[model samples]
Target: QPANKVFPHFVPSLSGFSLTSEVKTQDVEYDVPKANSTDGKDEVLFGAEKGWLGTPIDELNRMPQCAPPLSHLKVVPNHTVTVRTDLLREGEVPVPYPTKFKDAWDDVSVKMPCSEKNLFPMETEDGGGVQSRWELIHTALQGGFKKRSHLTILLLQCLFFPTLSSLQCLELCEAQHLFEVVLPAMVSLALSAPRLCTLPIPLLKSRMNHSLTMSQEQIACLLANAFFCTFPRRNSRKSEYCNYPEINFYRLFEGSSSRKIEKLKTLLCYFRRVSQIRPKGLVTFTRQMVNNPPNWESSQTQLTRLHITCEGTIEDDGYGMLQVDFANRFVGGGVTGHGLVQEEIRFLINPELIVSRLFTEAMEYNECLIITGTEQYSKYSGYAESYKWKESHTDETDDWQRRCTEIVAIDALKFRHFLEQFLPEKMVRELNKAYCGFFRSNTNSKHLSAVATGNWGCGAFGGDTRLKALIQLMAAAEAGRDMAYFTFGDAQLMRDVHEIHTFLTGRKVTVGRLYSLLNQYSSTVCKNCRTTRPDESLYSFIYQKVSSQTATDALKVISDGTDTKNLW
Candidate 1:
């Protein structure tokens, strides 16, 4: 059974509340400190330099060098693309060879009409008729279809054009441009797949900092093949790709839902934009792992800087910072399915990210995937079930080494029992996972940027927001990065987090102290039947304990005759 369905909602209590407990109905406003101008150099934040793009590409462990050897390519030109038909073999020579083409068509066949096949006549201009969408796609794949084929235009029209009653002039024009210009060019690019993917794409395996860099054209070609559902052994769980996320467009095209339609609109928009102007920049995907775990109780790392707010989103306001993706262990999560949360929406706008699922293995607990240089193509409104594609977005963010944006994907644990999260072992697991994502070994310590994150693992994963905020805070501080926390419109959470952060920083709290406090709190909760009392919350406990400890320290100092004059 799914964990979410099994766990009851567990709300924390706040007894002995010394802090302001009144929940604010209105949005709380806070000012984010601006970075001082660096005269075209990297900005500095909290005594550390901002952004990692200035670091050399080679130094970052990026693959597919500026000029990679063609011999490393598994799908070279004038050769057959050898799809991995089984698990990767040890000591095997990965290469492409001539072979017969085999199609692994699934139940969701593309033969069905974009609309209803029976609704329109199938007659063509050449005194013949097209039977199915597959025929057109197959012809294009074999390089026999004309760019101006009327049948292709009709199919595209059926796919994109809405019913006449609701079709506006602008929508019609966009659809017209897509079918007439963008799609044909993309189909042509797909035909040249052999040349575009000339470099051997390495699988970003577990426990490694393996990076793969591919040009935008190469990504487009790969996506084009996905659109055509040309990749073999990818449609079924019985195939070798059973361990990988689905890459073909069959599932996207075959489904019927308002959610699916909106996703399709977003994808079509991405294809249209890329087809018109092929991007020249390169994107890198790196799988990062942490072999040596931190000793949470003994570490003396100080809390880094923090900027917490209830307004704005991680992607929008957190620009130039290392953005966090509340992801599934499967990488792209449910972008290809019904999911429309933070990670899925991100993948849709930046469709290039979808390519990572092709070679990225299912992540381990100590692993995270970092993607840099991918551009956004669409804007969106609403979330989850209410998600809608708003319009095209033009990104003007500056790039370093042809890379602009950076995102780190981390999967949080899904708790089966609500109280299980309070266990010491579970809390430690979360800290290490967040630390792995935030840590940057390739760059100098002074060059690490702040992390932009929100209520990670708090939504469907059932993580307590207050606890998660603190966990990420400790992890970021240990990794030597500051943080900007967005509450996703939770005003009360934002205020509470801000107050706690101010208290910790003002008290000169160390990471070790914080970790010890967390364990103490866990022990208290366990002693009380593994559930917090209605009047007892993590915040109140920390506030009361820290206050008591500070008072005791002052008393001790006075008794020892240290600063007695000041105490009097």
Candidate 2:
């Protein structure tokens, strides 16, 4: 249970309508974080994280609208509350308080006001800034949102990806779900509110194991299953050991020299500052150049797959190549480089590792591998490769890894935009079709039943096969969208169909209060257009059928099974 998790209970429809309910009037306040303990160091040390993150007026907007339309009061003898919306308030979102929404993850509170001023009240050192931790929690509580929740989600999205380095070195485990739960809901809610229905999509989890909305790669991958988890590469051949030559002397001179040389003999005051190499690919590996630290006379070398060296450089350049940040890679962390290196970076044919879906077929050819080693001496030893070159008496360049660095660049620009537009639209269109069939009183099909839950690929839910590779290409922080994809899945579970309407309208709505509110959609009409639309086509047809059977079946139970039509 030490692992982190977020449970999503609702996705809002954008049309901004509401269900029938007795209005509960209450004041609002929020919570925020503030500057507290000192560093106790010589001069106090502080970071920008405190300044921008803690609290602000813009951050307190998480509370849902004060009064939205309500769909109640017109009750028949059978208990079905016939919702009348003309008298309802406008734009309302109640903090969802689920009595039976399976496992609601975070804490829930509704007996108090929602605001940061009276919540966890705190001011800045100069009384210039403010913070509200309570406001953050209050935003995502009982109702659909609080401003702090929105702020929390935004911060995570920014960090989920970094344009600078592939080395992800931060620990933000708590903020994951604060953004994850609201993303798809907010997106779909924005889209469907006015239409009387909305399409549903799953959120994805980034490297932190916390869920997130969607990243560029994940969006593309889920859009058409064109991408999956991997970079392009050939498979390894039979058990063959690779042999990349060690670094030589001349190579040292080309390295940036920040750690300067000292008196005639100071044992390697010869190194320089590390130059950050900008990768043309999605993940940029910033290799820090540091003075070789003393390791008790012991020397080590890592067989890197690629490296960059200067042209016509000799072996005696007093330079060496190495790898750092390997520890962070081996240990568990968030999902930044996982898509590219997340899986066991080994041969799929070996069968000990999960094959990268992107390269599974391609791995059958052009296999590549790396080999390396290191040696040290007690006294003055010229550059490493210099001696090797002399010992061989042959003018051969012993550079393999560095030589592998080529000018070839992979084209993945369209991956993000394609997914952003494709997946959501595909799901929406499909869900819409399903909605049309079941509700019109003229057409309902049992054939669409499979949409409630199904599978698209190898995942437990309606798995999206393309998301793996595409997400790998996205920067780390925002990649959590895949987790949401798995959890929320396709409407029919991505089986015979993988769109929105097929899945949601197909399943039995399990939330009791949600059902009651939705059931009122049977006779609800758009005030502006005078067009009647229910939450779902089937729900509509059933409502009409059941309303006709009001004298027989208990209308209250039926009404409780539908969605309130207060949505625009």
The TM-score leader among the candidates is 1
Scored against the true structure, residue 139 in model 2 reaches a CA lDDT of 37
lDDT by residue (tens digit), candidate 2, 1-568: 1111111111122121111223343332212222221121121222322111111212111101211232342323322111122232222211111111222112121011112232333566876654443344323222432333443343233212112111011123322332344333333322221122111121111111111111111222221111111110111223110111111111112222211110001111000000011101110111111122112112121110111111111112111211111011111111112111111111100110111121111110111111111111112212211110001011111121011111100111122222221243332222222222111122122111111111111232222333321121111111111101121212122121112112222232122211232233322321122323223343344345444544234455556785433211
Tens digits of per-residue lDDT for model 1, 1-568 = 1111100110012122111223334433443333321122332232122111111212321112212232332323322223332322323322221132222233322111121231333777887654655444546445432333443344344334222111122233344554456556767766555445543455566666666656666687778777766554566889655666777665665435657766766776777667767666556677888988789999898877676656678778776678899999998888877788999999998899998877777899999999987878877777887776666776642322334578999999998666778789999999999999999775544566678899999878989999999999999988877788888877678657766776776677789999999889878755576344324788988999898988888899978888844322
> Roughly what TM-score does model 2 have, to 2 decimal places?
0.14
Q: Can you give the lDDT of residue 471 in candidate 2?
A: 21
lDDT of each candidate versus the true structure: 0.65, 0.19
**Candidate 1 clash figure, as a count:** 4
For candidate 1, which ten residues in a row score worst on lDDT? 3-12
The C-alpha stretches of model 2 lying farther than 4 A from their native spots are 1-353, 356-568
